[model samples]
Target: MNLALKDIRHGLFRFVLTCFGLGLLMTVVLAMIGIYNGLVADALAIVKAPAADVWVVEAGTQGPFAEASSIPPDTRDAVARMPGVAAAGAITYQTLEASHAGRTLRVYAIGYELGRPGGPEQIAEGRGIATSHFELVADRKTGLLVGDTLRLGRDRYSVVGLVEDATNTGGDPAVYVTLADALSIQTKLDPAAARVQAARGAEPVKRPTVAAVIARMEPGADVGLLVATVRQWKHLGALTEAEQEELLLVSVVDKARRQIGLFLGILLTVSAVVIALIIYTMTMEKLKQIATLKLIGAPDRTIIGLIVQQALILGGSGWAIGLALILTVKDNFPRRVELEPFNAIVLAGIVFAVCLASSGLGVRAAMKVDPATALGG
Candidate 1:
């Protein structure tokens, strides 16, 4: 008795094809949403990996991640002497390109005190750097496995461990080494360049510096008060774990987030337009049936229900298809794609509302089709 169901069944093949095409569009929309979530997660990965209570950097700067910060390596020992500081470690950061197995990989280099506050929280394979020098803990994304040795700077390092999701805000996998090794690589002069400089009566610059000094507070210690005390030091700046995350999100990845949001907005708008046009055309093709129903004294609500029902069916089916498509290939993306349950549910609600709203166009056109059209046909 339902006109929409009857018509859809009569043209089932066309209806399915339409849904499949619409599903591809929905998949694109869902992928955009996943990409934005992934961007935020990726940006926070390394920042959250270290289990430190507070971060201390150079004075007058938001160093470590947001900006360049080079503090005396001894700062770690000094910070450890402060009240309420249980432990401290010096950490350094830099970007380096290395080649392995005929492929070049961009890596974010992190130097930290061994067995300290700055090491990765979780290791998926092997063990943390046990030998100190020339032993590295690498993110699995770097395509390096345990026992695999790669060259960085002038030194060769063996991959001793692999960590998951340990990448920097820039989406490069992180490689961890001892503070001493990192300093040597980052600050050491190239041998050829050093010789040229020496010939010119210049000494190789060797400033012992670390990007930041990380501190862990004792049980029930006040992080705010500790940060305040650290900041009182003329040569130091400090922030809590929360503040560090905020700095990365609000400053480091802010532009990329805005760009992704704008792109998502455009895709949603286009989806609405496409849905409206599809419903309108489908309604146009059913004009004769609409006129026949009107001639038989069917009420306006019944005609409206027919168009709305068809629109919902199409949208619901498309959403399902899109979900499948996105899941099948989500892992294939170069960057991470995180599709959370909350986001998917929220998108579903919006899609349903759009479906109902789009049906209005079809209902309006169907209502205007004169009953006299049935007589002519």
Candidate 2:
């Protein structure tokens, strides 16, 4: 009684094969969207991790996450002494390659004042660094395990703890060590270079300072007032959490985000064209059958329903398979792939609309089939 059902049942293998192929394409599209979300999320992770209200960095330079920013380490004490400042800590960030366990690891070294504003708020395993020297809390993605010895600069450090998903915007794993240790690695003079400077009568290099200051506000404190006060320093800049996030989104990853968006648009366009072509081809193949049905007094609506049903089925199956694929291997990806529920819902809606629009080609072909041709044949 149902012509669409009967047709699909007769060509079950082909129908399923088409869906499988379409599913693979949809999976790729979904993965790209997930990657974009992951990129933005990872970029903002450090700002979110600090849970601070104010970020103070060198004046006229965006923080290191967006660009190079360096400030004196002693600025933390100055900022802490300011009115309405609940706590202040110095944070230094640098990208370094360290050798550990016979492997080279690229890590973002963070210098956090333990038990202060700059340290990670929570630890996933073991304990936060309790010693000032040679202990580290590293992101698990670094493949670092507790008790593993890492050679950073001229000193050796032991991984004392691990955290999950604590990666920098570039997906590099973060290694949290004491402020002193980070300072040494960040600006530690190359012994050979230091000797050369000494020979040239240049004073031996002193420890370089931090890149930024993270500060928390007291309960019910006015952040605006605090920032205005800090701005008077003339050599420093202060940003609230919202401002920092905006800077990252607009400055740090804008091009990448736009690039991904353009790719997604192209993929959707290609998908629509491919679906329309497939439906149009299928409709052409069944011209005689459609003519016969029309001659038998079947309505145009029935023909339209058949084509639309196939499109919907194709798109729906593809979406399901794509979602499944993203879930199965997302965690294994080098960079984070965050597939949120809202993203899935929006993608599903897009595919549905595309399927409906794609059916237009088949609808036109079916509507043009002549009932007279069936009687003559």
Candidate 3:
């Protein structure tokens, strides 16, 4: 007795085909949203991984990630002695193209104090770097497994451990090694280059200098006071963890987020137009039936119900299909795709509202069908 159900059943194949196509489009939209969320989450993971209270870098620069930052390797000792500091460690970072098994891999090398504040917090497999020299902990994404040896700069390193989700905002997998090894890798000078510097009466750059020192404040410690104290050193800059996260999230990923948002808006607009046109065409095909119902005493409410129900069915089915597809293939995506439950619920609400609003065009056309038209047909 329901006009919407009867009409859909009458052209079930066409309706299913149309819904399938719309579902594909919806899947893309959902995936895009997930990808954007994943990007932001990944960008913040490096900052979160350290679990530090404050980061001290070279003055006037955002440490290690956003800009060039270098500080004396011994800065950790000074920062740790400050009143509110609980622990401190020097950390260094550099990007390198490493070769293993005849294939090249790009990696972000992190130098940290072993068993200290700046080292890898979790290892998925193998053991943490047991030997300081030439031992490395690599993210599994780098495709380097335990016992695999790779050449970095002028030295060779053996993969000693594996870490998961340990990548920088730039999506480069992080390779962890000792602070000394990182400094040597980052500032690689050939013997010739070193000899030239010595011959010119310039001291060869020292072997071990770190980029930054990370510190954890004691419980109830005042970050403002600690920052003020560190500033007096004149060679170091300090940032609270929250400020570092904000710098990476807002300053590093801002353009990518905006670009994704613009794409989402365009996709939503296209979806609305497609839904509206589909409903309008379906309504046009049923004009004679609508007129007949009008002549037979069907109320305006019944006509409105038919259009709204059809729209709901279309949108609801599409949403379900899209969600399923996103879940199934999300893991295979190159970059992470994080589809949270709340995000799904919100997108569903938006799609439903859009469908309902779009059905207005169909409702208007249906309401104008003259009762006399049924007699002519």
| Candidate 3 TM-score to native | 0.93
Q: Per-residue lDDT for 1-377 in model 2, tens only?
A: 77777888899999898888888888888889999999998889977888989999988877857878888889999989888889999998988899876888999999988778878778899889998899999998999999888989889999889998788888899999999899888766888999998999986677588888988989988999878888888999888889999999999779999999999999989888888888888889998889998999999999998889888888898889889988998888889899889998998999999889888888998999998889863
Could you tell which candidate, 1 or 2, scores higher by lDDT? Answer: 1
Instruction: Residues 57-78, candidate 3: write the lDDT tens digits.
Output: 9999987777879788888888
Cα shift from native, residue 354, model 2 (Å): 0.7
Candidate 2: lDDT of 69? Answer: 85
lDDT values, one for every candidate: 0.89, 0.88, 0.88
**Candidate 2 local Cα displacement, residue 282, angstroms:** 1.5
Sorting all predicted structures by TM-score, with the top scorer first, yields 2, 1, 3
- C-alpha lDDT of candidate 3 relative to the true structure: 0.88
Candidate 1 overall Cα lDDT vs. reference?
0.89
Ranking by lDDT: 1, 3, 2
Better of 1 and 3 by TM-score: 1
TM-score of each: 0.96, 0.97, 0.93
